[model samples]
Target: MMTDLHVVPARRGRAVRLAKGQAIQIINTHGQQVVDTWCFNADDMSEFMSMEHLHATLQGIFPATGDGLTTNRRRPILILEEDTSPGRHDTVIAACDVHRYAALGCTQYHDNCTDNLRAALGHLDLRTADCPAPLNLWMNIPVSPDGKITWGEPLSKPGDHVTLRAALDCIVVMSTCPQDMIPINGAACTPTEVHYRLIA
Candidate 1:
């Protein structure tokens, strides 16, 4: 059964705590918005879902249903239980930050996934020293055979979702990407809200 639904507002983030065996269903309500996701051990913040470790563990960049998302210590922290979309989550990009925006030619501060993660954790009286690369849900970055990657719009339709089961007691964070500078969210470059729920 699922509990009350929660919303990750556009250009912002939210964090939820899950017990072992529980799962989170993240819905792409508007379909095109990219949700930057991260997971950390509740008892030990340093041990977080690491894209590098996951790459080595899965022996691939794209994680599919039933694949274990590994932590920095190379242990499973969550399982990709179900994916209703095209199963094209990204593992290669770093979360967007102020520096990234500046490099993009922004003259002033801008909302970014990195700060969103920090702010989300701060809401729970939690803090971490580093920001690990995020699992870019619904963001499409196509790779060429010659080591080139091209940003593309999301392929998921409205209401598509993915369910991730907690392998350990952990905190999962989601950020509705605010990248208006690119078409990663969609061809229109507009980010929208997403909904999620805790499943028992």
Candidate 2:
């Protein structure tokens, strides 16, 4: 089935269920913003995501086309179908939580990403009781050759996006990043959108 394309704004939330072989595009409408994303196996919620495995398989710091995003059990969850030509996304940065909020002097924004995640899960009839770690797309955090990581400027531009193809029936939860306390998503907390399309 082909799903109509939809656009959502930054700091907004969207939930989607992607069947095996389907593709989803998270669009950075205004650019320089991060999108926190998470996924779970529709058949088994316990089979969560494994960033370590994904990084291992991808064999690099950032995700690129043809890289396989793996789950906790070392199973392929999604495939990177496309990425911006000059932009590089960070997979090491975990999703925002209350602790990070307090450290960033934006404790008030604590619920922003969390709220989006919960809302997305609720849309799929799922619960936060099993919320899993998320992936930060379009976030540019540079790591030194010595392993020191620094939050860098935004690497994406207007209309930049990352596309992923589901390898299994999965529930995807995402947050149009509202991070204004850091340079990762730029100083402005702009909005983003998610576009879905079925692949034949």
Clashing pairs in 2: 9-192, 10-191, 10-192
Tens digits of per-residue lDDT, candidate 2, 96-177, equal 6677788877636455677678777777788756446577877777899999999887777888777888999987777877
Tens-digit per-residue lDDT, 122-196, candidate 1: 999999999999999998989999989999999999999999999999999999999999999998888899999
For candidate 1, which ten residues in a row score worst on lDDT?
182-191
How much lDDT does candidate 2 score?
0.74
Residue 179 lDDT in candidate 1: 99
Best by lDDT: 1
Q: What is the lDDT of residue 48 in candidate 2?
A: 62
In order of appearance, the predictions have TM-scores of 0.99, 0.87
